[model samples]
Target: MPDPHSSDAEPRPAHSAPSSLLSRIKALLRPAPPADREGIRAVLEAAHDHSILDGESYAMISGALEVADKTVADIMVSRSRMDLLDVSLSLTEQMRTIIETGHSRFPVYEGDRDNIIGVLLAKDLLLTLSDHALDIRALIRPPVFIPESKRLNELLHQFRISRNHLAIVIDEHGGICGLVTMEDVLEQIVGDIEDEFDDEDEKTIFRTGDNSWRAMGTTEIEDFNDVFHVQLPDEDYDTLNGWLAAELGHIPRRGEHFQSQGLTFTVVGADGKRARWLHVQRVSGASSSPETHTP
Candidate 1:
């Protein structure tokens, strides 16, 4: 009873067939409902077995681990950079420097600046008369010294075990070269550890060399320029090192030196792609050179 010549009686169109095929393909591609834990584990193992931390995070952890292997020379503020009090000073003079520097502790040195007596607490001084005759031998706490090559983690453990916050880092000859505090170690773990004494406007900076400093990677280009007195012409890069590299057209190396404006930039450390630490000094004047040692 059907009309065979009519289109309605003919086969379906190619376009219509393709639509049906597409729906079937989509259904096949759809994800399977999540299975039981064991089944999921099997699927995960089958898919891939190795995926851990990615690029940036891995670098951060590696850098921190490197801290453990580094000697105190890698991080310690050298004696030249230290703000210390001479024990021979009239008690009034010692108190004055303390108030100016806002330092709670000072390394007491004798006749030769190299000879360290002991660590003195400012609060102890505050309790006594500044004009009173002082005997550093009586008030002194025992000096804590560690080899420059000790691992930071080991040093930290020593700090905890000994209940000591201050330590003098010594060279092979037993000469005092630098000092480290509990706060310095804590900063590595927690990042930019600040105290009530730290200035709000000041950023945490590491002196990378005699003439340069390494700043936090996140620092702004403007802030970097202001801090270092560099006149980097390009507005493109955010860090001083980034600007330097862009200007030089290559990554800088250790002992490689450059200058701009009134500042001298010397590479002290690096991690291939970027400058890790830079030693900066003002060209207008020279400060007394501090003795450096390889631990």
Candidate 2:
């Protein structure tokens, strides 16, 4: 009020260049903080553009932010795709499934798949090896049920506190819709993390016999072409499974087949939304020998 242009009238706070990324971000948002996700995104994009945050860190942080907005239903394995165990099955039969599926844990149901009673750990079955008198039900751990609408951030908190890796998702009417796992949540932040069961380098694509080969659905389109020496035209799609789904016009089911780009892709194994494994056969008369695509 005394002098509008005088520096002495109102001593302004010296805005020194922020030392750390956190300080820089705080400095950028100053008096008005981000209002919503989009506002936060704007601030993050600004930081990203200014080289305040590196590519990897920005991607992970952005993924974590995305997790907060998503619900369990977004990434959950659908109820139909869940590999559940039948409580009525004999121990021998259960062991077969455990061996085949390569899953560490399975949800055990009584009469119906919807009637999930508890979870069974594959390691727990080893207890029956030494002690033949142990009851099967005794090994079953209580199952956790979560609402599908529950935010992934809250679910992640619950997973951390309860140490429960898996939780059954239910609808508003208490109907089983799907299941979510800690791996699923973690993948959202850090991208895909491979386990022991995941396809290894050479194991990604295996030569079955003759002109047929077995390939994991996650196989990269480029890898597939490199192995078979054929151009599959990966313009929009990245993975073979993704491209197959688009060609089929829907999520491929086991036994369904699609022919494209001089190849026959048969869904050998599949879940609700994606193919797990595929049988690929060279339909065109390519000069490449079958031995070339081995492994």
Candidate 3:
């Protein structure tokens, strides 16, 4: 029989020893560097340069960092663009709106959009179709209200804990300002998350003819400038529509044309108030101006 505690016994393998204690000790001894935003950005940029992060991943990391600074108001769908359902509307009417918008959820309002009562999930309507007597109120889940000034990162954490996807943004006066969704928050990080409803081939801005182009209202001003090879001041507003509206001092109606900065902007398609599609034609040999105009 082998003698117990014998020195002659086969030595334990060098690699078999637990290294967690040493690792912990080493970690404790190493000085931790301060992690400021700039430091974090430098690290991320370095990682991107080393091919450890792809372009998309790098952008997302930057966006995540940005989320800490941005408030819900920065990314929320403005009240004007919100597709709200009136609880008083017929079920069929509500269903029609749901189909037209291609949105999965809608804020259910009472008399006005500001007086939001609850949220309506499109899937919840399926059960009510069989029984007309079924209470639509029962289908509405409790709505989540958030302040416009709420930091997006904090909101994301709250969303995770509550398992709620949508939030109604309110102002200091407690009036509904707009609505925010998990998708909206995520888009800030992942760029646009196009779904089946989105047209993959759709162009936000397209050249129509020589020195002429067509742009969607929602097109980003930066993208427009890049495409047109012209500098359009993007300080006050982000979207072409918003810039046009600001210049006009109100939303322009269809057929309204305005010229400024050596370009003619015509509202080719509009929805009574807001310009939906704009036709832009650059004036031949026209000198550009530093100002935006509504004339």
Tens digit of per-residue lDDT, candidate 1, span 158-258: 89999888888898899988888876776565555544443436764555345545454334568766666555554688776787676566775545566
Residue by residue across 1-295, what tens digits does model 3's lDDT show? 8886898898766755468678888999996663799888988898899999999889999999999989998878767667788888778667655654456788998887788889988888776786765556778989999999999999999999999889999999998888899987887788766543434256677665667776777788898888878777799989888988888888876556777677888775454346666778888877777444543
The list of candidate 1 runs beyond 4 A from truth reads 1-64, 129-131, 199-295
| TM-scores for every predicted model | 0.49, 0.66, 0.58
How many pairs of residues collide in each model?
7, 0, 0
Candidate 2, residues 1-295, lDDT tens digits: the string is 4787887786655654444666878888886889899998888898999999988888899999999999999988777668788888777667655654556789999998899999998888875866555556888999999999999999999999999999999999999998888988988888766655566665687765677777878899998889877777689999988887776777877666676556777665565668877778878664432222111
Model 3, global lDDT: 0.79
- Measure candidate 2: CA RMSD: 9.8
The top-ranked prediction according to TM-score is: 2
Error of 1 at 70 (Å): 2.2
What's the TM for model 3?
A: 0.58
lDDT of 2 at 73: 90
Model 1 lowest lDDT segment of ten: 286-295
